[model samples]
Target: MTSSLQAALDPSAIAVIGASENPDKIGGRPLLYLSMFGFRGEVWPVNPKRDEVQGRRTVPRLSALSRAPDLAIIAVPGEAAVAALDECGEVGVKVAIMMASGFGETADPAAQAAERAMVARARARGVRMIGPNSQGLANFGTGAVPSFSSMFLEVPPQDGPVGIVSQSGAMSVVPYGLLRGRGIGVRHTHATGNDADVTVCELAAAVAADPALKLLLLYLESIPDPHHLAEAAAIARDRGLPIVALKSGRTAAGQAAAQSHTGALANEDRLVDAFLERHGIWRADDTTDLVAAAELYLKGWRPGGRRMVAISNSGATCVMAADAASAAGLDLTP
Candidate 1:
């Protein structure tokens, strides 16, 4: 496992820079999540104005923290993200997840330059940055919810075998909400908004290491590193772990939209489809399709033969199931 990803995934302590008092605010939500989700490690809230953030004592600034944290979540605006990271670096923080959204998403030349500068600074300081506009990461098993997504409030987290990684915050949790609604437990649901440093593929590979993970769900707007992604898929396949992916931007309009959203070039739909198929990964059209086969994937079942039979007491049900089977590419033979 890479050192950076290891730090992001299993940090011993976390600092919420720009921490707020309100639980709903971006600055305060991580603290709220860590508390609600039962994170046991020390949580330092870095806020100058507040004495305490959500009952946890405030450290006023990153340097004031008693000890350097393994992971830091910068919740300030895009303009101040770099400065916040600078402090994190001074404190020797290993990884910083920037939750602000203005760096590269605007497609502006200066903003793009700022995004590069952020990455450059992180490297110089020996700290890894996850996203310039990321929603943050979640580990339900450890209760390390380093995100502000309200999905957890709506859909309670469970320590199951499912892992989720996405390029968009909404896309990441939307699928999570649906999968949870269907009674599936998820262990990791991570959103790499801009993916300035930690690409979705890298994070996916890290989560694949969990022995408990049976299924990995990915929602990507771009294929930043296909070689690594294919390698990750190969590893999962070897372990009998199925990877289901929803790579958006199928149409020209969708491609443009995705490009603007993530500030990256979208891979051609046909090529992405081919890549996934070659890697033994299933391609999903939407959230529903992405997780529909989830239960089946968890079952760890494979057909011995193509020939099959549909048995139902009701003639109508039999006909419907037979139609579904045909749609699923199963051959019905006597």
Candidate 2:
């Protein structure tokens, strides 16, 4: 992972551009989460129209900051977001979490052009962006909840051994909510919406590098960068970390939805399965399957072989277990 992207995961300071006083707004939710979760870092709120946001003093612009923040959250809309990115880049912000929309996801020619232009501008200025329509990222370990996920408020966070990375914001936190509900702790939950600059695989590589993580769950609508996914799998494999991925868009209907949702091209499903298998990553059929074995994985259970024995209080249950095991390619022996 690049140093800039790494810094974003544990930034010591954050700037909220286009910050709002209302804690419910997109621009204000980050501040709400950051405070509610106890982020022990400097926060600079940038809003030309406001003197303070959520009771914290605000700066009129990024240029007014004493020094460039480690990460900047661009919460404005349309061209204003692009301008904020340019400002962040010029001020030497290491990474940016862009929360605006109207990018390539709309599938509009002008919007696509604008997205390309925005990316070029950031690349020229060396600022890595999270999304043009992202929900944001969260690290409970450091209380760096840059995301606006309502799940955080609903589920409450605890520092645990699990990490989640996904291309869809909902996918990212849904797994988190499930894991947390199952009494498993999740440390990282990041959603790279639209994958404008940072892809899910790239972020997976970063999350996989966390030594504290025991299990990594992923939700991918596309594999725009398979190389990074492979790299992430290798890292996890070497560290004995288990990765479960729910790669969507396997059917015609799902494929169309994936394209419209994120402007993503569907990778051939068969090839995706092969690639994941070769890299030692498990493929899950759905969200439930993605985190179903999280507890077992975290417990460090390593099955010696694909052999199974069914034990149940009822004979019918045992019969069903045996049938399921057989279908899953496990040898059912006495």
Candidate 3:
């Protein structure tokens, strides 16, 4: 399952369902990114209404394609998205990125049931789904960006050693933007909203297997599957790759907000902390804390212990460093 999920990250061919001619629209943005980023893959645009989308000849639907694409990006809304999935099952498309919303996050009983039904449909057809309300996934390294993030447009991508996997779309790219600002190159950024099918940790495990990665960052509202989270951490630990995670919803109000945002149930904060610690994953307090030490980790500096000696040209600066070290619980040796 992990291998199959990993394959979606670097698909040789992709079909864009609900393709649009307008570049700024959700359906068109992916086509623009794929062309702009230079994804050297077969791109089939599926839009029954259009003969062409973004200059590419369009197929009426997935069934019209000669063969199943490696991945499908479903950009339609509500029942339309489900209908697209039905087509995918018939055509044998193994993976899909669900960009449509109005699912479990809406907190409507019908919507939640719809989300569950979609997942059941996907599983029955052997299709692995990324999201039902996802922003999408982007692999800058391969130019295989199926996402419609304005962040990619606002912040130019430079492929590097870092990868980010989050349940929130904003959190996924927030670290990317921060790292890119510091001249850090990011290779993978993915979000699994609603987690109706694929959870964040499962995707992180796939990302962790990339030989080019040095660091992995995660942002989560919940952990419904700790087994995969542990698997992800094990993979990272085996590679000596640092995993920094920001698990939100420590308070009752925060938990409520998280549940509303992604249909996530909050885990006890202390247990989450212990679980991450046991797996050798660092638990960050905030977004800033998540990427603050990225550079240091990328430089291959792994401190074996907390004992440290402050060294600086200025005596005052050294004193400040010592103070900071002490505050962080690092022992300052005389």
Best of the candidates, lDDT: 3
Residue-wise C-alpha lDDT for candidate 3, range 171-243, written one tens digit per residue:
9999999999999999999999989988998998899999899999999999999999999999888889999
Ranking by lDDT: 3, 2, 1
Q: Which candidate is the best by TM-score?
A: 2
Location of the lowest summed lDDT over 10 successive residues in candidate 2: 325-334
Expressed as tens digits, the lDDT of each residue in 25-128 for candidate 2 is 88899999889888999999999998989999999999999999999999999888999999988999989999988888886999989988888899889999
TM-score of each: 0.92, 0.95, 0.94
For model 2, the superposed segments whose C-alpha errors exceed 4 Å read 312-330
* Model 1 bad stretches (over 4 Å): 305-334
- Between prediction 2 and prediction 3, the one with superior lDDT is 3
Q: What is the Å distance of residue 161 in model 3 from its true position?
A: 0.7
lDDT of candidate model 2 versus the reference = 0.90
Give Cα-based local distance difference scores for all models.
Answer: 0.87, 0.90, 0.91
Instruction: Quote the positional error of residue 36 for candidate 1 in Å.
Output: 0.7
Q: TM-score of predicted model 1?
A: 0.92
**Per-residue lDDT of 163 in model 3:** 96
